[model samples]
Target chain A: MQIELVYVPIDAAAVLSGVKAGEDGAVTVFDGIVRNNTKGRQTRYLEYSAYEDMALDQMRALGAEAIQRFGVRNVAMVHRLGHLEVGETSILIAVASAHRGVTFDACRWLIDTLKQQVPIWKKEVFVDGAVWAPGEPFPAEIALG
Target chain B: MRLEVLFFGVLRDRFGERETLAQFPGNSVADLVRYYRVIAPELGELWSSVAVAVNQQYSRASAPLQNGDQVALLPPVSGGSFRNIHAD
Candidate 1:
């Protein structure tokens, strides 16, 4: 399992190469990119920030859980911080397994869970103004106070 | 006790990045949160939605605090794509 929060652009080819092996039949990848607009508002750019150490810890835990829960052979997840322009990949997820079904399932679950549980945040810079993108509520158990 | 307090996202913008509270009167995470709410009453409803973390772990409001503990006040994390555009 590999998990990282990086400042530079995410290299999808390099990450995919590292995860694939001869034994794996399918390698599923989820590439999340910055879009040109959000809800019809034109986006100028985006800035992502993370509670570095804590975010990494949470991401690593997600990768481990994906492996265990889906029985995938390997998992790699990376998210980029700092400035991101439209068309730039913001986050990447790769899952390798002997079969395709579990690979796809694991990849989806990883991204969904990470978005909710991880301590990373993004600010959307729109044509009109900038606002911290409203976040999904924490899972009931995690939201204590 | 002295504790390090960190804020993130919207909270960071409102309260800066981090502050050191020396001789903090709080005994638990809830107490520290209440103290912040009193000083920045303008925050109002935002305080009730924040989640607390102690030493990088998700902590309960009743979690006890000690000297040198690192506490974080986290707004709901905005990791995925944008949803509601009109939010302040």
Candidate 2:
């Protein structure tokens, strides 16, 4: 299994490769997109910036962990960067395994772990000309939720 | 030795995109935080939510610092788009 960190359109990669299901095999894919709203406000677009080194290291580590934890082989991941309009694909993950169970399990772990650990910052630029970025303000209740 | 650390996102806006030279004492991430606390007290309140990277790699805030390493300050993240199911 291999993992890649890049700044590109996530949708292109997600559908670029189609994994074939071997006899008794299965494949699982997941795609994360830019949504139209956050909390209750409308969003215009998203800008992602990365702490490249740390983000790659963490991604690689997560890939290794996924392979070891679930007997999943043949994993691919791609993340987008720069400015993206709403409803655009931002991240994509694909996995192929002999069975469906392990594949789904591995795919889930990769997505959840990446969201929590990656240094990617998604700054929501709203229609009203306001931008809400990480490492910025929000009430304690807002920050946690 | 002082390693130039670049700022990004909110940190960049708050501290500016300019690099900051911080002297290393080879301490844990916590120690570095403390050092920065003394060096740039304005950042103290925002420390907990911030993340750090050394030479382009994400590291634990508890990780020890090394000389000549390029450190970066990272904020939070969000994104995940699964493409397909188990196959091949």
Candidate 3:
């Protein structure tokens, strides 16, 4: 079980490492990307920041929950802080299990819970301006203002 | 009592990179914010605009405080990127 918060150049190398660790039973991975458009504006990039201390704790809890609920084996999740451009993998989550079913279930739960609970916030930088990306409890993006 | 306070992003720029001791008659989150305002007025002006977390959970200014609480003050953030994002 590994949950990390790092500031690195985004790439698939981490995913490859995850796959190598599990040795091919079953591995599930998901990458959250920066979209080109948001709220009718073109998004150039995003700035992600976190209250590192609590953000890390929340991530660890989600990983533990996945282990308990899905009975999955090894797992690795990493999220990059600072800035990122379009098409980058802002967050990566991978779950491994002896069978594919457990891996799939755990993977879904990990991402689902992350979106709902993680303390990290993403600000979408549009072509002309910017906006604060609301978080879990508030979820401003989903609600009409 | 004084607790270690961490300021991030624009907040850091406003208050500068130094931890100031915040005195509280009662060690609660409300007192912390009040001390912050007394210490840095620029920070105080921007306080309500940003979000806060106590220990670790996203909390309000009035959240309860503990003896060794690791309090972080975060400004309105522009969070993380997808994959092919730019460098800051």
- The parts of candidate 2 lying over 4 Å away from their true place are A11-24, A132-145, B18-28, B35-45, B56-64, B79-88
Residue-wise C-alpha lDDT for candidate 2, range A1-145, written one tens digit per residue: 4455566665554443544435427778777788777665788887877766666777887777887899886677777788888778787777777888998999898888786666666667887765535333322321222
- Candidate 1 residue-wise lDDT, A65-141, digit = tens: 99999999999999999999999999999999999999999999988888887999899999999988877788887
User: What 10-residue stretch in candidate 3 chain B is worst by lDDT?
Assistant: B79-88
Question: Could you give the DockQ of candidate 3?
Answer: 0.20
Error of 3 at B71 (Å): 1.9
- The most accurate candidate by lDDT is 1
Candidate 3 CA-lDDT value: 0.66
lDDT by residue for model 3 (A1-145), tens: 7778888865566564754353547888777677787645788887877667677887888788888988887778888887788777788888887888988888877776676556666766788987555433323431111
Question: Between prediction 1 and prediction 2, which has the larger DockQ?
Answer: 1
C-alpha displacement of B63 in model 2, angstroms? 4.8
Q: Under CAPRI classification, how is model 1 graded?
A: medium
Clash pairs for candidate 1: none
Error of 3 at B9 (Å): 7.3
lDDT of each: 0.89, 0.65, 0.66
Better model by lDDT, 2 or 3?
3
Better of 1 and 3 by lDDT: 1
lDDT of 2 at A41: 75
